[model samples]
Target: MSRLEVVCPAGTPAALEAAVAAGADSVYFGFRDGTNARNFPGLNFSREEAEEAIAHCHRHGVRAMVAVNSYPQAGRAELWQRAVADAHALGADAVILADLGLARWARSRFPHLRLHLSVQASAANPEAIAYWTERAGIRRVVLPRLFSMEDIRTLVPALPVESEVFVFGGLCVMAEGRCMLSSYVTGRSPNLDGVCSPAEWVRYGREGPMLTVRLGDVLIDRIPPGDKAGYPTLCKGCYRVRGRAMRPFEEPASLDLLSRLPELMAVGVRAIKIEGRQRGRAYVERVVRAVRGAAEQAARGRPLDAPDLRTLMEGGRATEGALARGWR
Candidate 1:
């Protein structure tokens, strides 16, 4: 049996160390620029900070992956190219990428560097995975959050490269990196620029006894006084379609599959991912520890504990996500 790698998030240097100390096999993060999906202010790493963090992880026998997973602007490829070079120079175990051009550039420029495809590419099948691995040399592909265990098993036998799947944290309802909901409202792109529903455009207000959450002037949800208010991320927002208003895309909840660790490993999954790079160190540490404990237990052929992930979930709600084989 292959040892399942516990891939955790690290939005900052402190979070990187926190994840590593929490028993993560690998930690992934991005730079302060628009090169990553979590482009929120006060998050992400500087070049010096990234170098130091990579060295720290290596010293502790943990791997570090730099996320340069955004599309480059027209005629302005230097920024993305430099990020790839910088990651390689700092001894990153790999670079997580999204754009086709960026992947090609990274493979050509850094022939020996490991390249992992970001979930943003939406490669859920073997054909798509092979296209990148053969053409751009992507060694591993992070499967989108839209596949079931059956879907994963079917794709695994045909895949030419290794696969990583999200096991915990924020659930992306839309196809990874393909949704334009944030840009339609905030004029900020999630794929090309690495930001979705940026904090600048989010607002919370009250109407009589109801709390309303707005994203760039568009009212996403209104809750009663006692109901919890979630961050307006477009996808999780309640909306009206044909006179009825409800959360059609998905409810505001996090993904917690810690109890299903044995099944995930049994399906030939190489890595288990936790998704929350914009969160704090405490969140990073707690989630990492929980998933690590469960994954390690499963690796030893022991039953995994039903982890109490309520404290780490959004609005105290969590689901198995598409991994349970639900939805179409």
Candidate 2:
């Protein structure tokens, strides 16, 4: 088996150390502002914090990939541009980006810096992947989580750029990084603003036995006493479809593919990305440790001893998700 690189998340400088110490091959994070996809308040790094994180990762022989993944809003392209320049200046191993304009600008500005296509682009097929690789000079494409192991096995061999797949963490029901679910409700587009279900707009209330959940003005879901009250993202919420209330799109859960390491390795994927940048250091430590061990076991032809990371997850349950070609 190829030695699969474990790409973990680092919301802060402490999480960066925790991930590296837990045996990550690399760590991915973004700036504190809207320059990244996980722009939650109190999370992410300042320019000085980013510099420290990168230095720490390099000292431990791990690469640090900075995320400048959000699309630039009109007339605010300078913020995105500065983010790319700062990441390169700090010696980040790569910059994970989504916008084509930003990608082109960064490629021209920093020819030596590695550019990774963020999953927001959702370029699953060979021809689409090739567009980024041939034109923008992206060294790696963070493959969308929409692909199954079979799909990856078929796709990876055809691509020239290295592939990084999300083996574990939050499962996006729609094509990743591309969805406007949050924007439809709150008017804050995650693709453009780098936030999902922005906390200011999320409100929860209990009307007697029914738990009323609202994302802005829309009533997203109502759950009874015994039902699970998931964090109210529009996609994962229970919704009305054909006069029945059920999760037509997705259930609230994360993706834990600990058991599928060998299959992923066989498919020629160079790295496994764990998705969660707004989480704490403890979450980063636990997940990084578990995935690192799993990668090592897969290298030795041994089964991965599953580590229960549900406590570290959002709603306490996780699934194999589309990596198993999840039921529609």
Name the top lDDT candidate. Answer: 2
**What residue pairs clash in candidate 1, if any at all?**
none
What lDDT does candidate 2 reach at residue 135? 91
Q: How far does residue 10 in candidate 2 sit from its true spot (Å)?
A: 0.8
211 Cα displacement, candidate 2 (Å)? 1.3
Candidate 1's TM-score reads 0.97
* Candidate 1: residue 125 lDDT (0-100): 74
Please provide, for model 1 over 202-239, each residue's C-alpha lDDT reduced to its tens digit, 9 standing for 90 to 100: 88898999888998779999888876655678888888
lDDT for 312 in candidate 2 is 69
Q: What are the root-mean-square deviations of the candidates from the true structure over C-alphas?
A: 1.1, 1.2
lDDT of 2 at 206: 86
